[model samples]
Structures are given as structure tokens and as C-alpha cells.
Target chain A: LAKTTQPISMDSYEGQEVNITCSHNNIATNDYITWYQQFPSQGPRFIIQGYKTKVTNEVASLFIPADRKSSTLSLPRVSLSDTAVYYCLVVTNNQGGKLIFGQGTELSVKP
Target chain B: DTAVSQTPKYLVTQMGNDKSIKCEQNLGHDTMYWYKQDSKKFLKIMFSYNNKELIINETVPNRFSPKSPDKAHLNLHINSLELGDSAVYFCASSQGTVVTTIYFGEGSWLTVV
Candidate 1:
């Protein structure tokens, strides 16, 4: 599994765009980038995933550059409810492979 | 409907006691997993089962035993629990053993005193 690095924390105001970047320099070709959001005292929720280019969903958007070594999770018009810890994971189509989570970026959305 | 659910949302027990946490997924997924989140907020996989077969067993303590009676149910039983065992345990399931996104439950908080 490829190790990932991301910011420890970020601060954003409501109605602002928040971008969290993750670096996976050793990302393999078959690896897919996935982002998950975790609130305090709750399970982590899948936000968006992408192999390459940009993938957008109702909740968030994931941008993967050509090299695939890094990706960015974009949350549009953040709210206080969006304050949570975001994790970036690199995985493949393998069974039983662990989802190695790094110290996720804590985004605090202020009102 | 609850896709994944766990019983005993909060468990408070004395040290050296045995306890069990039950989990069931209504998503009809073939793979179920148990994860432990420590005080530092680090999430680690403890066990994974596919179709009632043990697939991934991390380097967890032998006291932690996971049993899956069927594809939709996975239960975790801890023997001789210690204070360090206090943490949030999450149950998750995926469509298959492959790299599909796993859906998680609300998690069970275990407090060993």
C-alpha cells in the first residue's frame, strides 16, 4: 500500500471553498484515490473517488492530476456541519487489503 | 433503513470481563470488517470476513475473536478486556472482497475500566 501525506488541519469559513490535498508519491498505476469524511463520534463517510482527472458528486469533488501521485478534495460552500476530519486513501482492486489511514486533515468550518 | 447496525452502542465493563459486540449489514455485501479506533483517532483493521471465511486478520490480540455466522452478520468477542481496549469499534461491509467502497455503521464505543 502506498503511504499518503496531507495537511494536519485547515480552517475555512462558511460559504467558502475548501480544498484538501493528499500526496501519494509512490502511488501505483492501478491505485485509485478515495476520500472519506469522518465526524466526531461517527463513522467515516465516503465522499468521492477518482482514478484520474476530476470526479464530482453531490457531496464533493475529487481532482486527480495526470501523474496520479496526488489528489485534491474540494468541498463547495462549506458549512459548520462540514467541519470534520477528511482522509485520503489509495487502494486497488485487491481483496483484504487494508485501508491504511494516515493522520487525516481536520477541517474546521467557521460560521 | 439501516444498512449496517451494531448492538450495545455503548459498552461499559470492568477489566478482565468478556464482552461481545454484534453487527449486521442489510446491504447484502459479501465482505464484513471490524475496525478499532484508538484514543489518538487512528483507525486500524482488526478482522475481515468474506462469506463466513476468515480473510484478513491483523496482528490483534488473541483475546479478540471474530465470528461470522453468515454473510450478513459478524460478531466480535473480547476476552479479558483491559482499559487499553477502550475505543470505538466500527463494523463495515462491502459489495465484494474486492476494492469496493465499504459502508460503515455508527460504531460501538467500548469502555473498559
Candidate 2:
């Protein structure tokens, strides 16, 4: 399993783009970068998953560099509802769904 | 329709008592899991089952045993619960061993007094 590092918290205002980066230096070849959003008292929701390059979805976008050592999650035009803890995980496909979560970046979206 | 659902969203019990949390997934997924989130907000995997067979068992306590009667159902039973066992337990599921994405259910808040 690959260990990941990310910021502890971030502050952003509404309508501003926010980017949270995660570093996985020992990422394996089969590892995939996955981002999840978690609200208070709720389950974490999957935002996006990427292998390399860039991947975008309706909720967020994930950018992985060519080296695959780090990745970024971009939330466009944030809102107060987007204030939540975002987890970046290095998911191994063959690990029987063991997603080791790191200390997620707590994003507080201001008014 | 809800994909993954767990019962007793909140559980309050005394120490040394046994309790169970039931979970069912309507997504027809083959793999199911149980994760524990401590008060410090660290999420850790406890168990994983595929087609009702045990696959991954972390260093969880022996008192914490997981039962999966079928592919869609996974239940967690804790014996002699302790105060330190208090945390949010999440039930999740995926379609295969190769995890593309795992869906989580609203956690079951367990408080052991």
C-alpha cells in the first residue's frame, strides 16, 4: 500500500476554485488515486478516480502528474455546502477494497 | 433508492454488553466491508467479505466478529464492548476485488458507556 500526504486544512470562499494536493511517493504501478468528500455525520462520497493525466467528473476534477507521485483535486466555484473533509486515498485494485485513508484536508468554504 | 443501508444509526450501550450492527447493500455488489472511524476522525478498515467469505481481516479485536450471510448482507457483532469502542462504524461495498469505487452507508454511531 502507498502512503499519502496532504494538507491538514484549507480555507476558501464561495465561487473560488480550490485545489487540494496529495503526495504519494511510493505509489505502486497498480495504484490509483481516488478522492472522496465527507460531510459531518455522513458517509464519504466518491468524487473522482484517476490513473494518470487528468480526469473530470460532474462533482470534481483530478489531476495526476506524469511521475504519478502526486495528484490534485480541483473543486470549481465552491459553495458553503462544499465545506467538508476531503480524503485522498491510494487505492490498490487487488487489495479487496482496503482504502487506507489519510488525515484528510478539511476544506472550509466561507460565505 | 439507497445503495448501502445500515440499521440503528445510533447505538448507545453499556460496557461488557454485546451489540450488533446490520448492513445491507442493494447495489448487488460482491464485496462488502466494515470500517471504524474514531473520534479523532481516522478511518480504518476492520473487515472485508466477498461472496460471504472472509477476505481481509485487519488487526481488529477478536471480540469484533463480522458475519455475512449472503452477498448483499454483512453484519458486525461486538462482544464485551468497551468505552474505547465508541466510534462511527461505516458499512461499504464494491462490485469486485479490484476496487474501482466503494460506496459507503450512513455510519452507525456507537457509544459505549
Candidate 3:
């Protein structure tokens, strides 16, 4: 499993775009980078995922460079409700593909 | 309807006692997982069952056992719980290994005093 590193915390005001980057230097070709958003007292929710290049969803967008060593999750038009911990995970294609969640970046969206 | 649900959203017990948390998924998925979130809010995978077969068992303590009678239900049993065992446990499900999305249950907050 590849360990991921992300910012400890970040603050952004409403209507602004926020980008959180994750670094996984040892990420493998078969590994897929996925991001999850978690709020207090609730389970984490899937935001977006990408194997390479870019992938966009109704919620967020994911961008992966050629090296695949890092990925950035871009959340547009942030709101106070978007305040949550964002986790960057590198998942392998194995039988028991476990998602290793890092400490996650605490994103504080202020109004 | 709730896709994934865990019973007794909150569980409070004393140390050395045995407790069980039940999880069920209505998504008709074949895989289920148990994750523990520590005080620091770090999520760690504990056990995963695919098609009722034990697939992933992390280095979790033996005292923490997960049983899946079928594809839709997975239960976690903790024997001799300790103070450190107090944390929120989450149950999640996915279609298969390659699928990127994993739906998670609200969570079960376990407090061991």
C-alpha cells in the first residue's frame, strides 16, 4: 500500500475554489487515486477518483500528472457545508483491496 | 432508504465486556468492510468480507472479530474491549475490488469506559 501525504489543514471562504493535493511517491501503475470527504460524526463519502489524467464528477474534480506520483482534488464554489476532512487514498487492484486513509486535510470553509 | 445501516448508532459499555455491532447493506453489494476511526480521526481498515469469504484481515487485535453470514450482513464482535477501543466504527460496501466507490454507513460510536 502506498502511503499518502496531504496538508494538515486549510481554510477557504465561501464561493472560492479550494484545491487539496496529495503526494504518493511510490504509487503503482495499477493504483487508483480516490478522494473521500468526511464530516463530524458521519462516515466518509466518495468525492472523486482517477487513475490518470483527469476525472470530474458532480461533486469534485481529480487531476493526476504523468508521473502519477501525486493527485489534486479540486472543489469549486466551496460553501460552509463543504467543511470537512478530505482523505486521499491510493488503492491497489488486489483481492482485498484495502483503502488506506491518511490523516486527511481538514478543510474549513468559511462564509 | 439508507443504503448501509448499523444498529445501535451509539454503544456505551464497560471495559472487559464483550459487544457486538451489526451492519447491513441494502445496496445488494457483494463486499463489506469494517473500519475503525481513532480519536485522531484516522480511518483504518480492520476486516473485509467478499461474498461471505474472509478477504482482508488487517493487523487488528484478535479480540476484534468480524463475521459475515451473507453478502449483505457483516457484524463485528469485540471481546474484552479496552479503553483504547473507544472510537467510531464505520461499515462500508462496494461492488467489487476495482470499483472506486465505497458507500459508508453513518457510523457506530463505541465508548468503552
Error of 2 at B10 (Å): 0.5
Which number leads on lDDT?
2
- What TM-score does chain A of model 1 get? 0.97
Candidate 2 lDDT over B5-110, as tens digits, reads 9988999999999999999999989999999999989999999999999999998999999999999999999999999999999999999888869999999999
For model 1, residues A6-95, the per-residue Cα lDDT tens digits are: 999999999999999999999988788988889988888888889999999999999999999899999999999999999999988784
Model 3 per-residue lDDT tens digits across residues B1-113: 99999987999999999999999999999999999999999998899889999888889999999999999999999999999999999999999766668899999999999
Worst 10 residues of 1 chain A by lDDT: A92-101
Candidate 3 — which residues are off by over 4 angstroms?
Answer: none
The number of clashing residue pairs in each candidate reads 0, 0, 0
lDDT of 2: 0.96
TM for every model, in the order presented, reads 0.98, 0.98, 0.96
Clashing pairs in 2: none
DockQ by candidate, in order:
0.68, 0.86, 0.67
Ranked by lDDT from best down, the candidates are 2, 3, 1
Q: Tell me the deviation in Å of residue A84 in model 2.
A: 0.8
TM-score result, candidate 3: 0.96
